[model samples]
Target chain A: MYFFQKNKYKIMLVASTAVLVVCIIVGSAINRRKAGGASDALGTVFTPLQSGVTGASDSVSGFFNYLTNMKGYEKENEKLREKIASLEDELRKTDNLKSENERLRKMLDLKENEKDYKTVAADVVAFEMDNFSKSYTINKGIKDGITQSCAVITPYGLVGYVSEVGRNWAKVCPIVDSKVSVSASIMRVGNTAIVQGDIGLMEDGLCKMTYVSKETGLEVGDSIETSGSGGVIPAGIYIGKVTEIKNDVTGVSQEAVIKPGVDFSDVNEVMVIKDN
Target chain B: MNYVLSYLTLAVLFVLQTTLGRYIDICGIAPDIIFVYVLCYSMYNYPVRAAVLSIIAGIIVDLYSSTHVGLNALLYMYIGLAVSNFASTLMKKNVWTVALGVVVLSILYHTVVLITQYVIAGHSGFVYPFVRIALPTAVYDGVVSLVLSLWAQWLSMDKIRGL
Candidate 1:
């Protein structure tokens, strides 16, 4: 009887496994068809369950049966995460070395342009709790040699100028601000234009390049770099390039849409030009 | 007294909704999984238990959120009562019905939140109006309702059989 029960259970298990295998094949085929046909259907389990499958724990459990059986998956996951963390730490160190090497190269480029200006390194501290604000605060303050009116830049382009200084913190508003004016010139053709800010363009991280003559050689895709004619931006600061050129019927100058290189949302650090 | 399991489930959903569900933003709003689940429970005969479960779910969500405490509990309790009363008038378990009900409940949830945020922030909302957020959110909730209903139905299967 014991052998009979054991044999019966073994048969049941084999039969179910066979059925499960067939079901999986059929399910995948149906999913492929559904994926091919339906605009809204997310055919796979990973596809966001717009159908409310997620609130159902049983289904999720059924789906992730491997995780359910290996209850130590969370522990295993934690262990693997720690291992990944160590690997990431090594990667970060390597990335830092690469960035340092790049910075040294940029420093060489800057030295070729000018010998007088000193670059002050600073990291971002806080953003206004309101995401609507275009301002971000940084770690450097008056004590860290950061002061008001200093031109802060990232590796890619001119970020902003330091606006407010506290004992340990400073606030900066980027050149994309409607009120900011940077003396910029087209690098390819060397035609001068003033990059000006307007409130309508702030949310999009765009500043208008104004004062370009209609007869000027400025065109779309032209790289805009700092002219440094005015002591403000100190020349050679890589701003963005002309993306669109529009001319007003009555106006003398054509408007070139400049796409700012630094995505302010993801900006981590900036250098403040300190040598005055 | 396994209200603890119910609460834990809601907590898990809230965390998942904020962290993972955020990626699935439809028209810029995620589906209201907790609200839809509450809507599902209101389908059953356990009115008082459903209301209490919803309140617990609400409180758990509040704990995870930066919003004011007890607000979700209050919102969910009323939604539970309303859905319970409404559930008796209709009995079909079709996905569309579940989807539509979820849309209504999600609009209600988000309208309250938008109002709350407007009051707190005191800033201008959008270019178009008093509430453009609710419509997209409602549509997204409708889209997500079929699955959320399945969850509620599955979780409440034992209770449904009891009734």
Candidate 2:
């Protein structure tokens, strides 16, 4: 009893160190396993607290997003109105002539004709917000039928896919994360390439397309879209556009830098594309 | 009374760190406020309490973080111990003392994280992360801790009477 009382500080330090090591091992295993009961319980409690804080923060940022993007929105609105007026005039002339073309397009029954899917919408409740990692947590999860690897998209394009799930919250590894890779294709030329995030480019909010064949004739401004080869992400979801192209270090293949279609900094709402 | 005050301070700082403080990123780097607080508090006040608080704070941060759960707690515990053990000799009752401590600790923290996450793992090249993320973040932390230490001093002043 005397020894125990005297050695309390030493015991505490050693015990804490041991606990930390055990936590490291268990934490890594849990991360590898994706989700667990403990994390689910933590999420169940923390999701509400995070959501409350996120709601308040979002209100402040929403005002800033509106203020900062106001000019761009005004310019785009003006351009769209002008385009609509011109299109209206053109439609008056082509109204009768386009009837057969529309009929033929309907007859072809293209995949674009289908505009429906089962999706769960979620709000970004929090962000990882550190230089070492780039991820976000959404307020929807297993309770909302979300699963790992489900493609997340904004109205504009692909954001990323779910990496971890809990009862009420999930973590999304965005396309800008160094760990993320997507099978993408050139919309203009049908050339397939792997769009992967790089640590260097992620700081600037850009991704790189690698392993593209030289014969693909990849060019700047070409739209990139998901190829759906993995089947986790649906085909035809817009990824981004090629901004720069360069030869690989070995010169055997080509690489292109892309700007993602979705503005991640401004995204608040996202839809999870659940598999059928 | 002091423990409660410190605990409250930690809680408020953490909430601020996760919420509004996140938007304060410059060049994709944000200051580590909780880290600065722990280093400063340990130097100025109770060491053992600061160490325990750091662990608690680290766990809370890990709960919200994408990294492995104990990575931060482990780092914070070690930082807490280092600061507490050395504070009596190294720290002085001066703003410069706090400033220098924060500066050195911030760089050390980033270096350790980099070594563990990328260098030891060999998954990523060191040059880019060191230049772009780690160094810039340390600079940011230095600037932030300077101001934060000053504010903490102001809050603790006997003349202020209410804090």
Candidate 3:
């Protein structure tokens, strides 16, 4: 008690700093491991807080959206009605195609593809808003069968994978973060390369595709997809389009700058590809 | 009583930092609201209390961050300690002190992060992140801290009056 009263703050500061540094150093060594106790404890406490805040913000923003769009409510209603009509028509066609696809799969006895994979849909409750970090927290977790290395994707393309899974929240390391790498291939030429985040290109929501042979015919708009080499991420998930090709710093290989298909800055909901 | 209020304020700010802060992102660089909060808090609080609060704030941030868990924690802890120590010596009341603290600390934070990335994680060289991310962000954060410091001062007037 005497010591506590005398140097309590100093003791707390040193102890906490030491603990945090250890978490950083040891946590880095065990990269890809699930979030430790601290994250889980905090996530458990804050997930509900985040969800509630997100819900409130969304509603508040939605109200402002309604207010702003009040001037065009009639036109927007008409457009929405037309869009719904067209969407219903498309939905019917899609239903027919889906049935046909199911029949064909049964007839051919083909292996299950991405469609057969189990997935968990999660809402982004919070973003890592800092200069040094690039991640977002999703309101899903072990209870939802979300595991580490599960591929996260938007409807348009790859978002990233689950890095740290908590009980009710998980941190997603998007492809723009420097630590993530996606095995990618050129859809036009089938030349395989590795798409990884680069510090320079990440600010623009771009990644670098390295290890492409110089002989591979690279085009400005060639589509890139996950090659599924590592087997963590399923094959044939659309990544992005190549925007530029440059000689890597090493000069041994050429690197293609890829523009991600998904607008990462605005991603709100993502599907986690979980192995059933 | 003040400590409770301060922590509650931080909790609310933490939520806002994660949610609403995304909207203010410019060119993929978001304002570090918690960093600003830490700086403001540290400038006025005892070093030990500031360190504890900063650590808590950093942990909350690291919980949502994609980077290694402890990096922000350690960074914020030291930042709190330094800012508080410096605030004791210098004129903590001035706008210049707050602005300079923000700019210097912003640079220091990013530089340390980049170093950790390159040295520890074997990531890319410093030149790219320095020019592309750090410099712009530091400037942005400096401006943001200046504005936030003024607001913080205004908010604390009631406590100052009570004192």
- On DockQ, the leading prediction is 3
Per-residue lDDT of candidate 2, residues A1-276 (tens digit): 999799976787788889988988878776543566656776677667777887988888789989999999999999999999999999987986778767877899744455576899998877774676678888999888998999999989999999888888888888878778889989999978889887788878898999999999989999999998878788899999999999999999999999999887676789998772
| TM-score per candidate, chains pooled | 0.41, 0.86, 0.84
- Report, for all candidates in order, the number of backbone clashes: 9, 0, 0
Ranking under TM-score, best-scoring first? 2, 3, 1
Question: In candidate 1, what are the lDDT values of residues A123-177, reduced to their tens digit?
Answer: 6543432112345556566667876777888878989776655545566778775
- CA lDDT, candidate 2, residue A31: 50
In CAPRI terms, model 2 is classed as acceptable
The candidate 3 chain B region of ten consecutive residues with least summed lDDT is B154-163
**All candidates' lDDT scores?**
0.62, 0.78, 0.81
Q: Each prediction's DockQ?
A: 0.03, 0.48, 0.57
Count clashing residue pairs in model 1: 9
Candidate 2 deviates by what RMSD?
3.9
DockQ winner, 2 or 3: 3
Instruction: Name every residue pair that clashes in candidate 2.
Output: none
Residue-level lDDT tens digits of model 1 in B1-163? 3455565666556545533453464433455666666777666525666767776666544433312445566667667766765665555656787788777777667667655543345533433222444666567767767776666666666666323
Candidate 3 has a TM-score of: 0.84
